[model samples]
Target: MATQTLHRGRLIDHLQLVVNDLESSRRFYAAVFDVLGVPIGGSGEDYFWADELFVSSAASRAAQGALTGRHHLAFQARDRAMVDAFHRAALAHGGRDNGAPGERAYHPGYYAAFVLDPDGNNIEAVHHGDADRSAASVEISF
Candidate 1:
């Protein structure tokens, strides 16, 4: 198993999605994360991960004999163009569009795009417009 790390935040330390097809999920996530500027942290025969997101095959020991149900996960995008690119890349790589890139009533400047992964999970990439942040993320090493 690979070491897992977390970026301290308000809630939810990390998320793992057990999928029926690891390669497909990997491809889909790779393309989408590429647009979001997040790198693939590491991978093993039964799994691959990106930052806080862990994707593994149902056969993996950690999967506990089941696959995850559809869930919604959103990634923060750098800007609207990155959100658009995320949509296009996802569509071209085994993802089905759930929502096109655009602003939403969720809040002001909530530009985002939504897509369903191969397992039907609602994946999103959003940009909350220009704003200040303490840090992009908190990294810890072991």
Candidate 2:
């Protein structure tokens, strides 16, 4: 495949969302991000985590009256500590706990957690790792 040409400007480093219902998404993302411990991107329609990612919400007509499958997203943590932090903060921010932090034997070394946002979107924070005899690996695929 040929490499695409680059544009002269600030490249799309990341994205921010404007949801129909910010409160709902807020709760959902809170729990999810907390487990990941990335931090809220900002306040109001905004969520903040670390310094690189920024998330803010807004009322979207496009998001209303239609159900779409576009809210699924994931974050790669530096280590298990970040994952654990995500889980904790998410719960505090109004997100419900979908799953606790743990290992998955199905994938060579999958460590992950799950949660449902206010909009009923499935969100997750996952870490890829190896299955060694010393660790208690469990099946997490659904």
Candidate 3:
């Protein structure tokens, strides 16, 4: 098989999830990201954020007084084991099991797990078996 080099980064500027209960959503996402090894980027009075996703309360100005409808966000995982850990952490912290970790027919070696976050959003962690990347991540300087 030919080694394919890919660059993964900066597709979406950001994603915001406005929830009815901010703290519950916070705990749920915090646990989920921790297992995936993405740290909380920062937080404010009504929200907390990771790399590209922001979880906030409906009361926050950015929420515009409405809760976001259900959204599905798939995160990248380093390996199959990380996908398993994400499912467990999500379930332990206010998430419901949507699907267990396993290889999916989405494509060869597409192993993943799904969980419903506090706002009923379908969250997924997927690991596309062994592959090569041009960079672990990319940085765009302002």
Candidate 4:
């Protein structure tokens, strides 16, 4: 028998979201992601910057847009075109557009799109290609 190597799939391993309220945020994400809430552990007042878990300052709360909990988590698209596909699927899945597919000049080769997952948390699908990478290479081989 010959030894063979295994290939690990490429996908999100873990994510972190910063939210205004924990419980409320969990509810929103649950509905959006279509998954039950799973406790992430560590509950108490130490979760926030000022150690005030109950009170979200007016500025912070307002900036959160819709949901009070975690804002956004991004995933890599399988390819450049998949970014658009994800955007369309997201919209069909009740996601609102935050950003459309385009190059982010600030970040080199940053190609991505942003969508709000029913709860106003920004969900993104991105493909980081070279800054100069363009779709112009696509030509009919025939």
Q: Give the top-scoring candidate (lDDT).
A: 1
Task: List the lowest-lDDT window of 10 residues for candidate 4.
Answer: 46-55
Candidate 2 residue 101 C-alpha distance from true site, Å: 0.4
Each candidate's lDDT (Cα)? 0.89, 0.55, 0.88, 0.52
Ranking by lDDT: 1, 3, 2, 4
Tens-digit lDDT string for candidate 3 (1-142): 6453323374566789888888898888889888988888778989888888888898888998898899988999999999999999999999999999999999999999999988899999999999998777776433
lDDT tens digits, residue span 68-133, model 1? 789899988888999999999999999999999999999999999999999999999999999998
Choose 1 or 2, whichever is better by TM-score.
1
**By TM-score, is 3 or 4 better?**
3
- Cα lDDT tens digits, model 2, 74-113, are 6666567666777777666655688888886757667777
- What's the best-to-worst order under TM-score? 1, 3, 2, 4
Per-residue lDDT of model 4, residues 1-142, tens digit only: 6553322233433344455455554444334333211223233432322111122322344335432464566755556687777777667666678999888886777888888865477877778884443342332221
- Minimum summed lDDT over a 10-residue window in model 1 is located at 4-13
Question: What TM-score against the true fold does each predicted structure earn?
Answer: 0.91, 0.53, 0.90, 0.47
Name every residue pair that clashes in candidate 1. none
Off by over 4 Å in 3: 1-10
